[model samples]
Target: MADIRIVDVSLRDGNQSLWGAVGLNSAQIFQIAPVMERVGFCALDFSSSTHMGMAVRTDHEDPWERLRVTHQLMPNTPLQFIGTGLRFISWESQHPEFMQLAYDRLVANGIGRFVVLDPMHDEQAIMETARMFRQAGCKEIIGALVYTVSAVHDDAYYADLAGKMAASPNIDRVYIKDPSGLLTPHRARTLIPAIRARLAGKALELHSHCTIGLAPLTYMDAAELGVDVLQVACGPLANGSSLPSAERVIANLRELGHKVDIDDRALRQVCDYFTRLAKVEGRPAGKPQDYDASFLRHQVAGGVMSTTRRQLSELHLEHRFDEVMAEVTRVRAELGYPIMVTPFPQMVCTQALYNVIGDERYSNVADQLIRYALGRFGRPTTPIDPDVLDRILSRPRAAELMHEAEALPLKEMRKKFSPKLSDEEFILRATMPADQVDAMCKKGASKRHYNPEAAGLVKLLKALGERPRQSRVFIQQPGLTLDIRSAAKEAN
Candidate 1:
């Protein structure tokens, strides 16, 4: 049996996939650190700029401290950071110096590896990002060949791209990031080998979502096709739109005569803990998905879909979802079918939302979309629809964006924030709103431990105690019992 390694993504991709990126906090992750360390994963899909930004925006947790502490607790496992070499926190891209500092601070706070991706699949940009990470002393750098379904994206395209990436000195490996789960087993048979042929001895990894119900099957094909690593998630975080479940993938690999050198006992604990945590938080656990053919048309990723729905709900326009989705497919094609990954997906969704809600199409063009027309992100896979491009560029806003200011350089950027701010704090405060960063600082560092089982039980006890009229209480289950009596009632 040939051996296949695993990289756990429960804390990052799975959390973002199933819970809108707010699922696991620092304490919850810390609770499983040692067990996860023992599970023998090559790395943890640790965090993204969005995930870290949300730490301050939604949870008021200091993500830097979280990573620092996690590194201390799980000293043996490498923590992976994913970046597009474009921007941090904000949707707009940043200057190279800004991104360089961001990457350097990440390495300082325990980010050992970087998954360098460029949403536009720009090889030059990807190589540049990989070099920046290398200069920051990143232990490993994996170039991402983002997979998408389009007339231009094919086996040869990926193979050629992988060859270029392998030629770069800074990139240690290449991974097929199937965010939309569009890779079928049929595609993998040819695509995997084609890419591997040009990898030039660097390892190949497969990271696919279960969005369209094909990733699990595609993963098996990947294993047989000699993918060196399979990125999987634990229970409650796997399946559905996330990656394949580690438990299921391991068992399947073993039955296929492949050796998976992992601790099953610790894996079960990891699964059980996440399952319990999901239930306690009243969060939906990922379930196996059905084949959805419509996914091919839009290729909108799971997280983008989730975020779109949330944003629509916030705007009290939830009922326009189907309309918005239809507009998304149309907008993507008109915009030259850019790969539906970070930034591009956001741009498409925003334009679609505007089209659906406005009186006329292209009535409210997003600055990002306008910038794309001006050749800001990269050359689109195909020329944009002429009419749409004209309309996008004709807008007065587009004219102003044409002469947009460049991002601040490192020394100049430092002038905007207090000199007292550390690199971590300075980056956060500069990229995010000052209020959000201040609120995170006010919350203090997150505690380092979490007891999943005790969470719900403690809430129950607190609820029962709030009832002044209640004197005594008793509870029993198949394997346990608990009884409580008020002091006043006992005295009576």
Candidate 2:
């Protein structure tokens, strides 16, 4: 089995990357930690130190409380956390040694490992940061080079940077941080090995984003090149704006004859949880937009279209969707900016096209929107479709209908809704005490958890430390009422 460590950044990177606006709550992190541990992740990038700079409560933003809660819930699993060294701790601050203080607190609170990502301001500062971590008794340091790939440079520059990272005595592991998902798989396959060769005895890691849809392949190539660790995101956090999924990569790698010792079951459970979470958050879930040149540039340049859409919505810009797209086109043209043919632009154009009075020419308009956005248009012309535009414009309550229609299949839907059950009640319902069905629903069984699969019911029951009783029966939908008396009797 090839030695591969799974470091799940769902709580830290995943949350910050996607849910930065709302920030993750302690409740959500508490719900996810055991699932991550159960899935056999080597570490959790629990929370970032960056939260201190942002004005938010620890409960609202910092994941420390959740990490502590998870420790209480699953005491057996070792917890690992991360801190970035990029932001400067204010010298005039109330707490003078903020960085060291944050570092000490995490270590004191059971975080066994740490990752130090340097700021874009300075590269060599990583050496000093690592030394400070070592002085503070930090073990297992991952010396991360952040946003290095975004620099206008050639392959040789990247190779030389890797070599500098390897030669740093303060660092334990050297990681190539694609703060933007710009590294193509072919690039990763070539570059990761070059870095690995430079750091023959030291740990080499790769961190890529799914913004360009190349993260999974990059992970595979990293594995092939003897990379030590690969950062991953679980569930909906796995693509578009998140990292490649650890579960998918491990499965693919194992199939290809290399071994990675991550727990597949845990990964799936975590993914299920996050997918549900994303739906609740009103963001698109699952694998990200397809990779292309435009998307890569967007990610590299720190584009804000995803965030921009939210801002536009808050300002009630839906009525001006077409105008907004026209503005997008105008700005791009004026600055010679590149827009990729990614799903986001398509979605934006769709919204714009939806608002315009559709003529047959509108289809061509949409096509041209895509072509021009991708920098491929020689003479992009507008096309329109009258009926299509009429259907879009005349439709009443279209947004509401669209929102309600985004549900997943029942089988998949059961994962996220926590039946309002008290912890005890959840155990009883999940255990399938047969007679407990009505009581379970009445006691707060979330509507989403009512599965027809007796097997899943049994597994869940077992996970909750309950043994199945004879009342474990598969009830077909819209059929027989659950027999409570008989099931209760069996349970007793």
In candidate 1 the C-alpha lDDT for residue 289 amounts to 94
What lDDT would each prediction earn against the true structure? 0.91, 0.54
Give each model a TM-score. Answer: 0.93, 0.58
Worst lDDT 10-window in candidate 2: 87-96
lDDT tens digits by residue: candidate 1, 184-229: 9999999999999999899999999998899888988899998999
Instruction: Please identify model 2 stretches exceeding 4 Å from their true place.
Output: 21-23, 51-63, 72-80, 86-96, 147-152, 277-283, 296-303, 306-492
TM-score of candidate 1 on Cα atoms, chains taken together = 0.93
In the range 1-492, model 2's lDDT, one tens digit per residue, is: 467877777777777666662445555666666667677666676654443222122232223444456677666555655554523222111221434544565665566666665332235456656666776676677766543332334465556666776777766777777766777767776776666676748887777777767777777777777887788888766666678876777788788778677777767777877776665545555456575775443332234554455556876765654355565443332323322223234444444444343343233334333333332222211222334434433444433333333223323333443656443223223223334344423443111121224434455445544544445544445654443334576667
Candidate 1, residue 370: how far the Cα is off, in Å: 1.2
Give the clash count for each candidate: 0, 20
